[model samples]
Target: MTVASAVPRLLIVAVSARRQDRRARLSQEIAGMIERLGGAFLKAGQLLATRVDLVGAELAAALGRLHDDVKPMSTRQALLTVTTAFETVPAGIEAAVWTPPVASGSIACVYRACHDGTDVALKVRRPDVARRFAADIAIVAFLTRAAAKLPMLRRVPLVEIADQVGMSLAAQLDFSREVEHLRRLRTDLADLPDIVVPAVLDELSSGGVIAMEYVHGLDRAAADKLPAETKEAGLSRLVGAVYHMLFVDGFIHVDLHQGNVYFRADGTVVILDAGFMFRLSDMARTRFTQFFAGMIRGDGEFCADILLSTVRHVEKGADVSAFRRDVTDLVARSTGAVAKDFELAAFSVELFDLQRRNRLFAESEFVFPLLCLLSLEGAVRRLHPLMDFQLEAAPHVMHGLLLTDAAVT
Candidate 1:
């Protein structure tokens, strides 16, 4: 609207800017503003949470709760959504019905329903979420450009990174696209018995509604009192899946936080929410392989070079030498002369800190490193504490380094 009307919005943002020290207060205020604005702001809130490398742990943790899905509409709204997608809300509705949602979140919510004596999870996309998210994207892009004028953000390349954030959110909002992601991951891990992906009911899937084989397994909460060994087994399966994704297939499941990966009674790993999947480019994969190889051999210089090169793509005018030194020191502290003595999670946290310090934190597009590092390390610590992830991933890394004839261009 008019500049006179825009004054209030700018004033609110200015008020938020003034409270930099009170992170929680700032985060809540910003999240409220975004929620009220009702579109791109929510997406921006979620994106802000994912950047632990740039925002630091506390702020990131606070923003991480911004759900991507909107509050569910009334039964009338649900019927309208279904009717809009398919001429009627199904003629045989009396024969099969869905129960109210058991869990809800930012992008969509889950409801248990039955058809032909078989149970399924009906995930419905929030009406108007896409429109609202698109609005927030515009706002965030404007903010990113505005932020770039500052000296500190010049090191971080905020604008390009923000574009990445927008793309990631767009992918999440489209249920039809997400179904394809689930299908591809299912195909990739078909041979692996320990992992499970819900079977998509293609006939029932549309842009707004997705029906899939319901996972009848214990969530992390139900398994809380179980034996340490039980938890370890669950974690092991998760770690194995991540290892295969990051090292073997070069296809990553981008988001593997507790809720996304479930544990069956038999200890199988069922991965959900594949919207953020990422594939590594051949050249980037090669460089990462070199970086891992250097880590295995305890070669600081090679490791430093690889890390610096990775940053150069997403960040400009960064102090490569200083970043390299920081990485070298972290590697030295995290590992011993022998790779077997290393701890993956501890080492990963140190690297996360390094990214924040070097201003080479997570980018929306170039997010493979963060996904791989966090999921792999988190999975290892949760599963087999004794299994050295670095040592296990090292051999694969070394092989890639040896196989690729390309230089680090």
Candidate 2:
């Protein structure tokens, strides 16, 4: 069914599922609908899965299934798209040898192949995905514009949010951008011994295709079966690498979904899929690092002030002082808490809810970093539940501060 028709049905589902138990069923229905839509809608569902605050934890968990569970296109269609990606097919690789897609998502399908004795993975963009996504985005933008006219939605900046989501989705359509992101991540994390970013085969890659070294690491479930020490070590490397990206390099892989991360028996981590990445400006990076630093030191006032600095526009008559006080209290209470004790998801929900209640909307730049951490928390919790998040972040926070000071001097 078209989204236009689906909307009214979705509204009826929402109204009927007022009870908590029914909401879980509603979440599943919504996710199934998104999967059927299968373009920008799938991407949107994956993103919404990160915001446990905006969507309740149950719905967010339901939507999170969209990350890796979508059905794949047929082998025939996948092969055709790969062949069309290049003017001349690369030597030693033919349709007969190409295996059915080992992994699939809304935008692309990945097939495993061997070229010149080297195993490589071919990521081919789905046929007509760009046009489909564009059409879907246009529809969303139109709906958002119409919704913004209502008094309740007037304060939400729905049009701007829709535009940003559209641009981000559009960027993922260009495989060359993912190639660039993978290369940069490889360089940035080169110092970390246990982390792996697969090498891209530049000669075989194009706008619609990515040919990269085929990594054969275990998925999250398989990795969980490994020894406890191995899991902890691999997870530590993963967390540290993320810290380096956020605080040191300021370039982050925002999509840390289960499908994108893998682990090996030797405690090595393999990170894949760089299509959804974000970079922070130097100012934004410094401000966020400073905020974390303040949180570490239990200085709620400092953290509150840092958050205020990142606000794009404050609502008229907003109670700025009260907002500051509440933020400060939150930081104080959360100080020194370990991952098991302090859930970033819960903390973020409360923090964002406070901002919404106080009408203090921070810039997306600042919010994105927190979301990155929230996304990472899933893997972190599964791998190392007892980790002291604040304690672990101290060193990287210090390094970030040092970098900021050096820049000023």
Candidate 3:
């Protein structure tokens, strides 16, 4: 190639490398800052961990540490936040005995306490967190919009991702919403006895503080310490519940990492932190349910059609025919494959990549479903590597399909 023509390619490669390097530096900076800031910044860092498409893998990995490593606000601040949230001395909070925080995150700190003769957990939003989040998100929104115009970044919904994530973060400050999310999830998943969502104690809850049933359980690694059957059954139930939320109800618990949810001693799964959730559009719900069911049925063409339907915009001159063919082949290859070997998370990631490669930008709702799939995949893989995901998912997947059919009919 002539030097003049080669310059454009060279420039593109250099820009890509520069962007990658910048993301790396930013991720490292963010991780350190969250550790020190201990408020809304920490919450945003944890939220960013689920957004691999916009933040990229390196940044998300760095932010992942915030889930467990977030520092609690000072003891004085914790108590003051609780007091402020309640607008007075909350019930069961004697000035003499306020337990140190049992858990802490960007938006809130959790303490174990007694309320009205019952043991409970108190979740108090950090003082000034809402102000901090509002200011920071404005910066994030601006940056994402600027980044979205870049050739490499244009394939992702950078602005929408930032906006969706910002709104989710903001929602975390409202303990009332978290309370409602808990109650609704409990009601919806009541049929799944093996799954547990702690009961909300409404009497002690306010806009910034919530009191709920206290749950004692092993952390996520509990699977390693449990019986194989227990682990498998718990994970299977978890997947089924997530499918129902994502496809049927379109209400998703977006922040369901290891720290936020875990397994109890009896193998009942415990989900926590309803601060960041996703409510999908009517169209997204129908299409996502159909697409997921298609995958379970080993129908790639069907999956591809649904995938195409879900996306909001596609670049002109993109070879959509070739995209469909590639997806068809991807689906065809998975047919009759060993269930343990299917690796749904990896396949889903690849499918998303295929969309990116074809210049298809989807709505923000899509990201959470992908993250949810990966989380479920990790939970199952750790407990039972040899277990068949397809066989396990088939029942729930079929239920979603039936629901979708009924909705249409």
Candidate 4:
């Protein structure tokens, strides 16, 4: 069935599953439907998997399988795509030596190969994937616009969110831009020795194909079984690197799903797939930093003010005072809580709930950073449960705030 037809079925299923007990089964059913649809729908599932605040933890976990479990193109199909993209087979790489894909996703499948005596990972875009995504995005835009007409969703900025998703999907189609993202991230995280961003082979890469250094490392589950000290230090480095990206540099890798993050035996973190990324404006970055700084200090009013300043729209006759009070109370309750005690997913869900209740809509750009953090929180908690998130973020927040103040001066 087409997306337009499938959406109504989805809505019907949602309506039928109103009872709390059926939500888990409902989530699985919806995930299965999306998986069968494939293409942009599968990509959307992968993103929703990270958004526990919006969909709840159970549903998010159900959809998370879309990250790397999609069916891959056949070996011949994959080879043909690479050959077509290059106009001919690139030298030093033979088709016969190419093994089956090591990983597969909505847009591409990754194969392991050797180039110039160095092991490399070859990422080839699926045939007609771009055209399919374009068609799906158009349909999604129409659906979102229609959904926005409902009274309950009028303040949600559905159309804008759809546009952002479309832009990100389109960017991912261009392998060349991902190359730039990989290089920039490598430079940005250079100060952190434990972080690894693989090197891209420009000569072998193109708009549709990317060749990069092949990295072998343990997945999150395997890494969790490592020594306690090693795991702790690695988790610290990973979180610190993420903080550096958010606070020190405005650029961020928005997709930090389980499939993209790996850990070496020695505790080095390997970040793969630079397809989905965004750069925050200086103002947004500073505001985000200030907000976190306030959270660290247990200053609820300050945090509320920071949030208010970044809102894109405030509904007429909205209760701004009540919103402020709610935010204040939320921060107070979360004060001094560690990763184990304070769930970012739960906190974000409450915060977004408050925004919806108050008809306060934050700028999408500002909100995406929080979503990125939410995406990483699962790994953070799994690796180091007792981690003091606010405390860890304090230094980066202070540095970001100071840098912004100096720039103003």
The most accurate candidate by lDDT is 4
RMSD each, Å: 6.8, 4.0, 7.8, 4.1
Q: Is candidate 2 or candidate 4 better by TM-score?
A: 4
**Against the hidden reference, what TM-scores do the models get?**
0.72, 0.85, 0.81, 0.86
Please give, for residues 1-409, the per-residue lDDT of candidate 1 as tens digits: 3334545755666565656556655555555555455554544455555445456667555654454234444566555455566644543331222446655556666667675677767777667677767876787789789988887556565677678757876778777778988898888778776889888988667657778888886364444455777767776666666656655556778666544666666767788877667777776666666666777677787787776666545455556667778888877776543223454445656765667566675323345555445544543443455766666666556545555753443
For model 4, what is the error of residue 159's alpha carbon versus the real structure, in angstroms, after optimal superposition?
1.9
Q: Which of candidates 3 and 4 is the stronger one according to lDDT?
A: 4
Tens-digit lDDT string for candidate 2 (1-409): 6767778877777788767657877888888888888888887687677555557778877887677667777766666776777788886445623556777788888777778888888888887788889999898899899998987556555677678757867888888888999999999999988899999999888757788998886564566698989888888888888888989989988777667788888778999889878888898899988988998899999998998998888889888998998999899889998776788867877776677668886656755677678777766665687888877788988998999999999
Two-way TM-score contest, 1 vs 2, winner: 2
Tell me the tens digit of each residue's lDDT in model 4 across 166-219: 888788888888999999998998878889988888888875788888888646
* Residue 133 displacement in candidate 4 (angstroms): 1.9
Best by TM-score: 4
Off by over 4 Å in 2: 2-31, 44-65, 96-98, 142-158, 314-316
By summed lDDT, which 10 consecutive residues of candidate 2 come out lowest? 91-100
Residue 187 of model 2, lDDT score: 95
- Candidate 3 per-residue lDDT over residues 250-282, each given as its tens digit: 788877766687866686888887777777787
Runs of candidate 1 with Cα error greater than 4 angstroms are 1-71, 88-98, 308-324, 336-365, 375-389, 395-409
